[model samples]
Structure formats: structure tokens, C-alpha cells
Target: MPTSIRRRLAPLLLATATIVLAASACSSEPADDGGEQSSPSPSAEPTDEPTTDATDATDAAESGGVCATGDLSFTVTEKSQAGGYYLITASAEPGVTCTLEGRTVEAGFGSGVSGDVKPSEQAEGEPITMTGSIKAYAGVNPHSGPQEGGVQFEEIIVSAHEGDMDPVSLKLPGTAEVDQPIGTNWHTDAAKAVPFSS
Candidate 1:
């Protein structure tokens, strides 16, 4: 070999080795040669849990719901005569809107009286809405039959349309008899509503 040829080949080989070393240093992958390697951090999508919109709660309130006992105020006053029957007025509290479905109300006489007064048979009727400044009432028959023992009730426990609520106790004007009493569906007109039937 000539000396000039050896010098030219040596420079070419050095340049190739430099290029190879630069590429190896710039590699973005982990080395598999038993050398320490950096690992990429785990990444995941961001979450938006534990947050709710205010409109959802408002929308639920606007939708019709069963009347809760806590939202009602009852009174025997404003009684409208429906022929020989009577209506017990029940007004809703402010900022409340609810419905009365099926047998909206049930009345039982006395404090501990469970089986004393019986609920009347009623046909399913359209739900009655009770809103702010609006009232609903149930029909009642003080005596639908003979007064066997002249049994009088001190107070009447009125249950609202809500099934999970406790019955509200309404004190009568005085101890009076309610024999085989019946009731009607809640309606806006107390005068025209008739007694409930099977």
C-alpha cells in the first residue's frame, strides 16, 4: 500500500465513526444493553368529576313531585259545602310546588288511632298541582252511617300524598264523630267535588 492512500482512508474512517457516535447520543429510545434508561411518565385524560350544574336542581323543582308533609299547612277553615259533604282545606307553603295523585290523602282519628278511621275507596284521578299561594283539599263525611257508640275523635291524623312522610295531626274544633268517612280527590273546586267511591 502507498502512504498517500493510507492517509486518505484513515480520514474517511474517522469521519464515519464520528457520525455514528453522534447519532447514538441523539437517540430518543431506551437502551437494552443493561445500561440505566429513563422511562416516560404515564399520561391520562383529565377528569371533571365532583361538580354539578345549578340548573339541574332547579329543573327538578319545577317538575311536578309528590306533596311532602313538611310543605303543607292544613286547616278546617275555608270549608266549602259540597252538598251534604265538607272539604278540609290544605294550603302549600311558599316556594313549593307539588302534586297529589291517586288517593292523595288519608285521615285517621285519635292520637294512637290506626284502625279507627278507614280510608274511602277512590278512583284514580288526574294529579292535582298545589303551588305557591294555591291550596288543595280532600272531601270528608263527618258521618256516613249510624252513630253506633257516638264515638268522637279528638284529632285527625292527615297523611299527604308522600308515602315516606309522617301524618300531620289536625285538632278538630271539638271531639266529633267520623263514621265510615269517605274522601274525594284533591281539586281546585271544593263545592263541586263529590265524595270518593270505589
Candidate 2:
């Protein structure tokens, strides 16, 4: 071949090699799909459920605790037996679980201890847990003394003990003649709660 023809063909061959290399590089590069391609993150996703510890804490707060005066409702039922005593029933409010601390309820017709009824000599029992419809009974013998005359009251104030908060005032089923009013310790059994002064 002639020297001029060889030089022209060499230039064309070099240009063709450059074009092939460029095309290969373009094919090796990744294609863009119009969005970022990255690994999914578990922490980034939103969650609606609470942790187990949190749920347990909420349940404990809703259920067990010491019984405050506000957690109970008191009702006085007049009893014809037992020398005309009043059966003071303490009922736990809705969804409350509370510990009954004292053996007796602090009951009185007046605000002071002078009007407070005394508890009987019955043995103090273990603390009772009042929950859901559970109730405790305390018997109060109005006019327990042999005095001919006594104070008349239509309502009675009741508390778990002295200094307890939110004491409830409950209307008696009927007017009571209170002299030396004596009360028995709170008992789950009505027989034990009878204020039998012996």
C-alpha cells in the first residue's frame, strides 16, 4: 500500500477505537430511575403501638393503690337488731383497687373527735383490698350508753381514719339517737362487724 493511504487509514482506525471505549464506559455506568436507591431504614418508619413497659405501667396506675377516702362511697343502713345499730357499708368505686389500712372507719356525727365513734375490742385484721364491687362493713351502735337522752343526727361522716382526705358524708336511712356511739372493726363478714359490746 502507499504511505499516504496508510496514514489516512491509521487516523480513521484511532477515531473508531476512541468511540468504542466511550460507548463501553457509558454502558458500565448505572441508570437513574428518577428516585434515590438506598437501603430501607426500620427506625425511620412510624409506629402506633406503645412499648410493653409503658403498657404495664399504665395498667398498674389504673388498678392497685392505697384506698383514699375519695375512692369509696359510704351508705348507712339502719338495723333493727343489735340495739338499733347502723351498718355503715363502704363500697369501692368503679375500677379502683385500694388497701384498707385501718381496722375501723373513722365515723362521727360532728367534725371533731368528740362525736367520733369508738371501735370495739375485736382483733385488728389484715388490710383488706377493696376492688370493683367489694365492700366493707362497720357496725355503729348509736346510744350505746344507758343514758336516757342522746344527740339526734340525720347524716354521718366517714373516713378510713383520722387525717384521711375527702371524707364522705352519708345520709342515714333514718334519724339516729347518738349518745356514746360505739363502732366495730370493718369486716367482710356481716357477723363479725356486729357491734356486740361484750
Candidate 3:
């Protein structure tokens, strides 16, 4: 063969080999079926929900009526001249409130001065002090004065608010009562009613 023809044939052969190699490489490549690349599955995110406030939780636990059956410390500061009237100063839990009912007087005394005392407005905070007297009477009417023995603080209900308890009779001193789902009450032991200077 002629030297010039050999040169031309060599160039053609090189071009054909390059094309073959490229086709083979493309065929060997893996096919993607439009699928996403394999990756670690993302962890699920937590759901969002409103959480209870610490203050609200504490209030709920301590807001119920007084506990039934417990010892409560009470102090009688003043007693009426008629032996029936009494003035008392009592201390409750730091956040607890206290009040006294069933006392007799002309009117406008203690929390009940506004006729009927509601539960929400009883007593608030520690050391709730009330000045009033009890009267034992025959008729069920509260307006009437006590008849002979005088009506006891028949029911003393304390809660985060007033009028929250079942209204149990204040009988035993130092004994606490759970009249509602939460909270407790304390009764005093002092007998002689002393003068409350404050």
C-alpha cells in the first residue's frame, strides 16, 4: 500500500475507535428511573401543643375548697360583751384565704356585710381577720338575733375564692376540712377572745 493512503486510513480508524468507546461508556452508565437519591429518612418532627403555665397549675391545685378533716390554727382576738360576739384573726397558707360566717349583728360586718357573701370574695391572702358575733336563734331567718345559745360559725368555707366549698359547719378547732377537690382549712384552739388592737 502507498504511504499516503496508509496515513489517511489511520486517521479514519482512530475516529471510529473514539466513537465506539463513547457509545460503550454511555451504555454502561446506570439508568435513573426519575427516582430520588437514597438518603437517610428524615426524623419525624414533634407536634406543637399549648402547655399549661406553672402559675396556672399551682393555682388549680390550690384553688379548690378547703380540705376536710385537719388541724387548723386559729386565734380569737376579741369577744363581744354579750359573750356571744367574737372577733378572730386567723392565719392560713401563704396563698390561702379565710373568712367567718353565721355571726349575728345589725349588719355590715365582715364579708357578709353586703347581704350574702359570694365565694369568690371571701378572704384573700394569709392571715384573714374577721370581726363579728354569733347569735343563737329559733327561726331560720338570718336577720333575727340569736335566741339562747347563739348560732355557731356553722360553716366556714375557704378556697382560692370564697363560696367555693360545700359550706360545712365550723365545729372542731384545728381540724381541717376538704370541702372541695383541692385546698384545706385550719381551725384555731384559743378560747378566750382577746381584743384585736389592729
Candidate 4:
């Protein structure tokens, strides 16, 4: 080959080699970045685990367990409205999670079922779950009849359901007039706890 031909081919060959080397280096960088990016993927997966666990916790709250009498603290207050009634608030104990099985509590003025408080609402309500700051509310109207002729009761025996093994005896905030005592279903909202028979 002539010297001029060699000279022209030499520059072309050198340029081609440099382009190949640059291309190889650029390709290698992305592979290293991919390895670095993969390092945090495991931690990201753990972050998603908490979200999944939250869903499981919600499922447990829905169908998990009933609240034992010992798992709650009860407070009875006199509600001035709705022809005078008793507002019962049940609060969950610390770190306790449980559900109220029925819409209304098994409540009575005395020991026998004859004194059992009738439910004002004909249709039972959805079960309410109590946890953390969540609370369940029920309203008891000691006398649904005209206020003139009603017996007096000092305290009410209450339970989460009928025949509950661990029932609670909550004192009335005031002397309640007792006749045909009626109660509302357990609800999250205190306003919905009015024990009106209508």
C-alpha cells in the first residue's frame, strides 16, 4: 500500500477504536447504577410490608373478636333531652381491640331477664369495633311511657350481649325512672344513641 493510503487509513482506524471504547464505558455506567439502585429495593419492600399489615389489621378489626367485659370501662351519664334518658359510653382499655357483637347491649334494671331493657330500634344495627380512642355509645330510656308512673332504679346491669359471662353493673348518674325501659343500639356517634321508640 502507498504511504498516503496508510496515513488516511490510520486516522480512520484510531477514530473507530476511540468511539468503540467510549461506547463501552457509557454502557458500563448504567450497569453500575442498576446495581446501586437494586441495593435499596429490599428496604422498599419492607416499607410496603407495613401497608399490607395495615390491611390485615383492618380485617382483624372487622371480624376479629368480641370485647370482654373486662376489656372496657363504662360511664353512664344523664341525658337531659329525649324525655330524659341515660347515655352509656363504653371505652376500650389501653391496647385493647374488640368488637361489640350486637347493636344493643343486654341491659336490665335488675338481675332477672324480666327486667331486661327492650331495644327501641326494631332493626338491629351493625357491630361496632372499639380500639384506641374509639368508643361505643348507647342510650337507655328508663321509662318510655308517660313520666308520671315509673319505678326507680339505682343502677343498671349491662353486657355486650345476652348471657354474657362478664357483665358490668354501671351506676346511674341520677335516679332513673324505670317502667318499660328501652335502649338504643350501640353506635359510634353519641348523637345516634337517642333511645326513641319511633
Candidate 5:
């Protein structure tokens, strides 16, 4: 072949070899799937641990039961008197019930309303004593079974109003029970409101 012809053929051969090499390289590379990468598998759930009856008991006591510990107090004040009947005022504890000697009484200040006490139908102006308590349970009818335990007060006086005597000034003695430490102000116009721990 002539020198010019040889040169032209050489350049063409080089170009074809380069194209073949590029094609081969492209075919050898892996294809992308366009899917998201998977994340690591989740860990196993925690196993149940063994617990004792004492541990359960402790939990119940600490969770606002009668066995739980706390302080509750109340002050009684007389509101008014009509036809020898005296209206009284008392306090209410949230999430608890108040009772006199386990007797469920009404809450608030008034005569014949909730948390007020009256003498028996045949009783005269006798000094009244009431033992009460508070509970988290929803109490049944006062005429039904005994009050459940949670918060309680015992032997607090519910005195009738005397002439010229201030009911709020009266101090009564009773037991105040709570499931937890409570700083609630309860007011009643009865003499001697005392609290005992159980």
C-alpha cells in the first residue's frame, strides 16, 4: 500500500478499536435498580421479668389505695340555723370521698345539702360525733354496704349551733386518710376536727 493510504487506514483502525473498547466497558458495568436501600432489621422485644406478690402489693399501696400513705384535714363551719336546724359548710377533696365514721356525707356548705350533718329525727341539740373517711372508689348508696377504703376520718364532732357561738371556731377530732400526700383545705363549722394516721 501507498504511505498515504496506509496512514488513512491506520487512523480508521484506531478509531474503530477505541469505539469497541468503550462499548465493552459500558456493557461490563452493573445496572442500577433505582430502588431504596433496605434498613437494618428491628431488635427483639424485651422479655417479661418475674415479679413477686410483695412487689405487686407495694405497687398497689403506692398507687393510691387505702394501704397508701397521705395526710387529709378539714375545717367545719356552721352556715345558718332555721327552725332549730343548722346549716353547715365543709370542704371537698378532689378524687376522694368524705364520710362521717364511715358514713358518706355530702360536700360543701349548706343545710340538708351535701357534706352537712343533722341531728336524728328524735334527737335534740345533742353533741354529734362523726367518724369519716375519704376514698377513691365511687361510693354506692349511703344506705348500702360499708364505704370502701382509700381516705378516711374517724370520730369527728358535728355539733349543732349554739347561741352566739361561731361554728368555724369549733375544733373537731377525726381521722383523715389519703392515698398520697395531699395539701387540701377542708372547711366545716363543727367543733374539734382532729386527724389520726392509720
Candidate 6:
């Protein structure tokens, strides 16, 4: 082309070349450090890979992680009489799973004159797994035979076995005529559970 045109285009060509070279140098990939790269720094940004915390949680879930107390909700179904005692059905809230091994989340009534609770004849020593809508049973009876009169209780409190577990307070369907209620440890078989003894 003409000399004037060539002079004008020369600067534009040089600028384009510089931009290309700078872009080529800006790679994010870590350069090969002769295979001697040190461990990842604590302050490094997270990558696409799963983090340690995520890995640990996954492993725990796979291995049956212990059920957190806060994640559990306990409820008492309506009370009914069976045999010679009152039966209380304890149920776990939805989406909860827990081990009853060595767990003593038991039921109790008023203190002092009202009397205390004891394990029912049916309380199971083996651990029962509670999950979802699954339920356990406890038997209670305040009045002892013909001589003992039933104690009137307005509310029933389920004691927490672990410090982490929260105790549940339930309003009785009616006055619990308890003399010395015996509560059974939570068990899968409702027949085996009995209320606490005073």
C-alpha cells in the first residue's frame, strides 16, 4: 500500500502483538515446581473438590453418626389402660434417628407426696433404634392396689438421659391417678414397658 497507510498500521500491529503476549503469560495453573510443591496452605481458596468438613460429614453418615439430641423431638400419644396399669406411647418426631443404648430418656410425674416413677416390668435392656415415626412405650400407675389411692397429676415430664437431650413436658389427657407410677425404659415391645415406680 501507500507509505502513509503503512506507517499508520505499524503502531496498531505492535499494540495487538503486546496484548496477545500479556494474555498468554496470565495462566492460573500452578507451574510445575520440579515435583516439589509443598502441601496446600491453610489459607488457600476452596477448589471444586470436596472440603475436609464435607468429607468428614459424609463418612459419619455412612458409618451411622450418633443422633444429636437437639435433632430429636419426643411426644406422648394418648394414654390408655392395659393389664392393671396406664400405658404411655412415646414417639420420636419425623426425620429423627437415635440409639437407645444406655439412653434413659424416661417418664416421670410429680415429686414429694405425688411420688416418683420406677422402671416398668417391660423396660428393655437392649438398645432400641428410634427413627422417623417409630415409637416406644412406658407404663405408669400411681395407685398401688386397693389400699393405695392414685395421685392426681396435671402434667407429665419426660426426663432427658443426656445433658444434650431436652426434656419434654406433656399435658396429661386428664388427671393422672398415680400412686407411685412405674415407668418402663423405652422399648419396641409395648407390652414389655411399665411405668416408673414411686
Per-model CA lDDT versus the true structure: 0.63, 0.78, 0.32, 0.83, 0.31, 0.59
lDDT of 3 by residue, 6-43 (tens): 99999899999999999887766633322323433344
Worst 10 residues of 6 by lDDT: 27-36
- Candidate 1 lDDT over 50-165, as tens digits, reads 22565677667665678777767887632435435445777778877787664645665664443244455445666767777776767665556644644577666777753546
User: In model 1, where is the ten-residue run with the lowest total lDDT?
Assistant: 34-43
Every candidate's CA RMSD: 7.0, 7.3, 13.5, 7.7, 17.9, 11.1
Better of 3 and 5 by lDDT: 3
| lDDT, candidate 6, 4-112, per-residue tens | 9999999999999998877766542344442335656655856888988999888766544444444446555444454355555655557655665433345567646
lDDT digits (tens) for residues 19-98 of candidate 4 = 99999999999999988887876646555345777889887866458877887889999988888889999988888778
What does candidate 5's lDDT look like per residue over 1-198, in tens digits?
Answer: 899999989989999999999988776653322222233333343446535776787765454322111122334322222211112233333443322222222231223233333222221222222224422211111111134443343323332122213233223233333222111112233321211111
Task: Report the lDDT of model 4 for residue 127.
Answer: 79
- Model 1 gets an lDDT of 0.63
- Cα deviation in Å at residue 116, candidate 3? 16
Off by over 4 Å in 5: 1-3, 30-198
The TM-score of candidate 1 is 0.59
Q: TM-score: which is higher, 2 or 5?
A: 2
In model 6, where do residues sit more than 4 Å from their true spots?
A: 1-70, 77-84, 102-105, 122-124, 162-165, 194-198
- Measured against the true structure, the TM-scores of the candidates, in listed sequence, are 0.59, 0.67, 0.24, 0.66, 0.21, 0.54
Model 3 lDDT vs. the true structure?
Answer: 0.32
**Model 3 stretches astray by more than 4 angstroms:** 1-72, 81-84, 94-198
Q: lDDT value for candidate 4?
A: 0.83
Highest-lDDT candidate: 4
Better of 1 and 2 by lDDT: 2
